[model samples]
Target: MKILIAIGSKDFSKPTLKLGMKVAQAFNAKTTIIDVGEKISEFSSQLVELAQDQLESWDFDAPGVDVLEWAFNYLSQNKLIDTKQTETGFPKNRLIDDGEGRKMVYLSGTACEDVNLILRNGDIIAELREEVQFGEYDVTILGKSRKRNMSHDLLQYINSSLLIVNDYEDQKFDKILLPLDYKDGMLKVAKYAIRVALALNVGIDIFTVFDKDKSQKKGSNYFSKIIKFIRRSGVQYSHEEKQGEIVEQIIKKADKNKIIVMKASDMSPIKRFLKGSIPLSVMNECDVPILIVK
Candidate 1:
C-alpha cells in the first residue's frame, strides 16, 4: 500500500503527521509526505529557481524546505526512518525539482517501507489530486480544513480513499465506529477498518442505520457476511442497528472518541455532485477523524 500525507506546517500539522504515520505504519505502506506551498505568480515562477540557488548559497533553505526538514526530524525522533539516514540529517541538497513546480527528497524508512517528502506550489486540491494520480496512492491523509469547499472538492475529485484527521488525540480515541450498509463495496471498507483497528489497538463498533420511513431490509446476507468477517479478524467489536437519518445517526454515534470508517457514496459523480452523499455529510459534520473508503 502507498499513503500520501498532506501537511501544512509544523505548528498546525503535528497531529496530522503523527496520526498519518501511525496509519501508514499499520498498513506497512510506502509513504509520502507532501507540503503544498502558496502558488507563485506566472511572472515570478521563472525566478523561483534562481531564488532557490541564492538561498542555498547563503546557507538558507528555500520555501517549503523547512517543513520537509521538520518532517524529517519527526521521523528521525520517532525512529521511523533508518538510523544512518537520520544521522546524515535532512538532505536539503538532494531535493530535486522536476520543473513542474514539484521538489522531492527520498529516505529509507524503518517502520514503513520508505518515506518521501515532496514540496509543491499550487492550489491545494489541484496539487494533491495530481500527486495522488502520479503516485497511485491507496490512501490520502490530511488534517481537516476550515474552508468548507476544501472538504467538498476532496471528496468529489480525489481518486484515492481519504482520512480526514480532525481533533485527533492519539490517546483519546478508543474505537473505530464503522458504519456499514448492504452496499457492494462495503466489504472493502470493512477490511480497511479492521486494519486500522488492529493498528490502533482499538475495537470496532459495527453500526447500521435504517431510514425512519422504511423498515430494515429483509435479507441482509451481505451484512451478515461483514459481521462474520469482523468476527474472524479477532478485533473486539460490537454491532448495533439504529433507525434515523443516516448522517445524523452516524455523527451522533461517532462522538469524539471514535474514528469513523465508512464506504464512499456509490452514486454517479454527477448525481453525487448534485445531491451530496451521506459520507460527505458525516465528514463535514463529525468532530472525530473519518476514513471514507472508496
Candidate 2:
C-alpha cells in the first residue's frame, strides 16, 4: 500500500502526522509526507533554486523546508526512520526538485515500507490531486480544514480513499464505528476497519443505519458476508441496526469516541456533485476521525 499525508504547519499538524504514520504503519505502506506552501509568483518561482542555494549557504532553509525538518525529527524521535538515516539528520541539502513542481527527500523507514518528505507550492487540492495521481496512492491522510468546500472538494476530486484526522486523541478513541449497508463495496470498507482496529487495539462497532424512506429490512446476505469477514479477521466487534436519517444516526452514534469507516457514495459524479452523499454529510457533521473508502 502507498499513503500520502498532507500537512500544513508545525503548530496544528502534529495530531495529523501522528495518526497518519500510525495508519501507514498499520498497512506497512510506502508513505509520503507533503507540505503545500503558498504559491510563489512567476518571478520568485524562477529564482527559487538560486534562493535555495543561498539559503543553504547562509545556514537557513527555504520555504517549507522547516516543516519537513520537523517531520524528520518527529520520525527520528519516534524511531520510525531507520537508525542509519536518523544519525545524519534531516538532509535539507539533498531535497531535489524533480522538475515536476515537487521537491522531495527520501529516507528508510523502520515501521513503514519507506518515508519521503515532499514540498510543493500551489492550491492545496490541486497539488494533492496531482500527487495522488502521480503516486497512485491507496490513501490520502490529512487534518480537517475549516476552509469552505475543502471536504467536498477532497471527497469529490481526489482519486483515493481519504482519512481526515479531526480532534484525534491517541488514547481517547476505543472503537472503529463502521456504518454498513447492503452495498457492493462494503467488504472493502470492513477490511479497512479491521486493519485500523488492530492498529489501535480497538474493537469494531458494525452499525447499519436504515433510511426511514427506504426498505426497513433487518439485514441482507451481503451484510452477513461482511460480519463473517470481520469475525474471521479476529477483531472484536459488535453489530447493531437502527432506523432513522442515515447521516443523523451515524453522527449520534459516533459521539466523538470512534473512528468512522464507511464506503464512498456510488452515485454518478454529476448526481453526487449536485445532491451530495451520506459519507460527505457525515464527514462535515462529525468531530471524530473518518475514513471514506472509495
Candidate 3:
C-alpha cells in the first residue's frame, strides 16, 4: 500500500509526519513526503532563521550536507525515499493529481485554513474523490485534538469519506463494534463495516441498543429486526441487544483496542449536542478508532 503525507508549512506538519512515519514503518507501506510550498508566518520564519543562525555558528562543518544526508537516510531506512517538492504554482491541485493512486491523504485543517481555498489540499482531494471515480484510496486519516472530541460535522464528513484515525495508535483493534438500527443508512454502514472487518481479517461484534424506557414488545421487535439484518448479510458475525443509554453501554464494552462502527443520521446536530454521536464519543473517550458508516 502507498501512503502520502501532504506536508505544508503549519504546526501540524512535523507531528503528522512523525505519525505517518510510524504507521508506514509498521505496514511496510511506501510513503511519499511532499512539501507543498506555502508561505510561513513571520514568527515561524524568525524561528527558522534563528535555527539557521545557530547551525552556522556551530563548529560542525558541512551542516547543509549533514541535514540532507539525515533526511535521505531517514527516508531510505523506512523505504519512504520518494520525495516530491511541489512548486507548480498550484500546490493543492498538484497534490490532488499526485494522490491519484495513494492509499490515504493525511490532512490537517479544513478549507478555512487555506488562503486561495482552491489550494486547500484537504478539500480539493475530497472534491477530486467526488468527481473522479477512481477508488485509489481506502481512507483519509485526519488528526483530531486530544483535548476534546472532534466536531460533529467533521466526524460526519469523515464517516462518509474514508476511515478517520484519531488517537487510536496505542490501541490496535482486536474486535470491531458494529451498532445498527436496521434502517437503510444503518444497513449501508453495516455493509461497509463488514468490508472493513474482512479487509482487516478481524471479527465483528454487532450490537444494537434501544431506549431503556421503551416497552418490552418494542425492544423485542427492534432485536428481531437487527438479527434479521445480520443474518441477511450472510457474513460471519455475532450480535447482541442490550437495554441502556446508547452511548454509555457502547463505551462500557469498548476496550482500548476495540473499534465501534455506528450509523448517525444527523452528524451536524450530533456534533453540537454530542448526542447520537457514538463515534465521536468513542474517538474521544476510548483510545480506539471509530469507523462511522453513512
**1-294, model 2: which lDDT tens digit per residue?**
999999999999999999999999999999999999997778777688787778789888778899999999999999999998878788876899998878999998999988999999989999999999999999999999987499999999999999999979888999999999876778888999999999999999989888889878756788888899999999999999899999999999999799999999999989989999999999998999999999
Which candidate wins on TM-score? 1
Question: Can you give the TM-score per candidate against the true fold?
Answer: 0.97, 0.96, 0.52
Candidate 3 versus truth, CA RMSD in Å, comes to 10.2
Give me the runs in candidate 3 sitting further than 4 Å from their true place. 1-139, 156-159, 166-171, 216-235, 267-276
For model 1, the local distance difference test gives 0.92
**Number of the candidate with higher TM-score, 1 or 2:** 1
Model 1 agreement with the true structure over 153-234: per-residue lDDT tens digits: 9999999999999978979999999998766668999999999999999999999898889888754788789889999999
lDDT of 3 by residue, 1-294 (tens): 434333443444444444445544433444444332334466686686577458656743212223223333444444443323212221222223244322222222221111111122224334333322332433333444444633444554332333445444423666778876544446566666665555455678887776588743333465466557666755567877788786777877766666677765554654446454566665566555565544
* Root-mean-square deviation (CA) per prediction: 1.2, 1.4, 10.2
The deviation in Å at residue 287 for candidate 2 is 0.4
lDDT of model 1, residue 20 = 95
Please count the clashing residue pairs in each candidate, in the order shown.
0, 0, 1
Q: Each candidate: what lDDT? A: 0.92, 0.92, 0.48
